[model samples]
Target: MVPFGRLLDALSEVPDPRRAEGKRYPLAPLLLFTVLALLSGATSYRHIICFLEQRRIVLNALFGCTLKRAPSLNTLRTVLQMLDRDALEEAFRQHARDLLPPAEPGRMPVVALDGKTLKGSFDHLNDQKAAQALSAFASAAAILLAHTEIDVKSNEIPAAQQMIAELGLSGVLFTADALHCQKNL
Candidate 1:
């Protein structure tokens, strides 16, 4: 899990997707709110909005800002839609890396790699398949180190390779299913 303060600092680096004109809320606060809401068990945007509404004062105090009001569902949707997803993921990984403790002498960290499908993400009406993702997990910390979506046209093997290369993981023991048993890796 990411420390809240570090999470804020990392997320603050992401550029605001909204235009300056008539912008009511800052991106950092909004993103912070969303993350907090998710941590608090919000499963959907409506729940996030509701959570923010119920904890508006506390959130304002925690953020040290008078947002005047919580963001609406539409605001959240628009921001999520427009935000650069790659940048957000990079920030998450960077923050997680910062939180990791140094390796012990002659001991390497254990990293787990796996592919899983997101539950209930299939668009049944449109006959779309569920989303698949390959994730690198820190076994000790029990936190996600990095992940990448497996494109519909592609397979988890390539996604795993890409994610591993992107993370540049070294001096760590990686455990994955036999599907990742490639000579190059």
Candidate 2:
């Protein structure tokens, strides 16, 4: 179903992590640029910056913002790392919802829920475990619905259920590994 809010407005709800004294860019525009860059297949921070610089004028007109250039690599990385994870996740969920059209009657949208451990996330020296998350993907639209971390003290089952409940995903056919087919799912 089509979400009810604008993506930039949704992004604005995410708490800014930068100090007010030296903040160079607005959080919402920087976030929107980053999102657009990722959707355009820019993989690295440098590539994202390059994407912005290359299309600065056009994108500025499109987004209705007059940014002279993209934020520096250091600023982008630091702000991203310091932002509240929950707020960012909520914003992403809303944006993903907005990307879809209304669901048709009698047709079940297929969503695939999967949990996987992220590679290269284990901090060997710090003794941290590999980070894992449960992701819900709208299969037909080829877009992510939502994802949540499987915390060290918890497992995928609760995370999956929580995500499903929070997104209010009724009238949809959800597919998952056998692990998610247990009672109360």
Candidate 3:
């Protein structure tokens, strides 16, 4: 199973004690949609719904969902939009840790940090660029940790430092491209 899938499973296991239920979709179905979205390169909620409709049976079986009904695009959009992004990130990180092999004491992990652009999806109304900074997979036991958006008028050094600081790479070796080789970076 993929780390993201395992993370979703772990997250689904957490009981919601709140008496006020917001939505009604089963955890398995939601997870199935998430996995399908990732696999099909669907970056938006609408795309995920379309992907789910096409692979209904396979997804249902993969996620162990017993739902007699299929979720609408609006339903999925509302549910996903309301979810706490921080909680989702934490779940993904925890599952990533679980999937990683045990690190040897003397052998430090090599983390390659870099940034990227999303190519599209920029909100034109807000005048925001569509650059999505991401941590690319470099090697086993290591990750390209964080990224910062770079615009025409702004520099990324400070943002990169902030990201690196949050990563807490005490024993690990960090490497980046020439853009990240600044004196303070």
**Best-fitting candidate, measured by lDDT?**
1
Kindly report which residue stretches of model 3 are placed more than 4 angstroms away from their true locations once superposed. 2-5, 13-21, 27-29, 41-47, 54-60, 104-106, 121-138, 141-154
Candidate 3: tens digits of C-alpha lDDT, residues 66-131: 655567877776666666665555555545546666667888776666666667758799997676
Regions more than 4 Å wrong, model 1? 120-129, 183-185
- lDDT scores for all predictions? 0.85, 0.84, 0.61
What TM-scores do the predictions have? 0.89, 0.82, 0.69
Which scores better on TM-score, 1 or 2?
1
The alpha-carbon deviation from the true structure for residue 93 of candidate 1, after best TM-score superposition, in angstroms, is: 1.2
lDDT of 1 by residue, 107-171 (tens): 89998889999999899899998999888999888888998889988888878778878888789
Model 3, residue pairs in steric clash: none
**Model 3 / residue 10 / CA error / Å:** 4.1
Clashing pairs in 2: none
lDDT of 2 by residue, 113-165 (tens): 99999999999999999999899999889989898789988888888888889
What TM-score would candidate 2 get against the native?
Answer: 0.82
Candidate 3, which ten residues in sequence have the lowest lDDT sum? Answer: 143-152
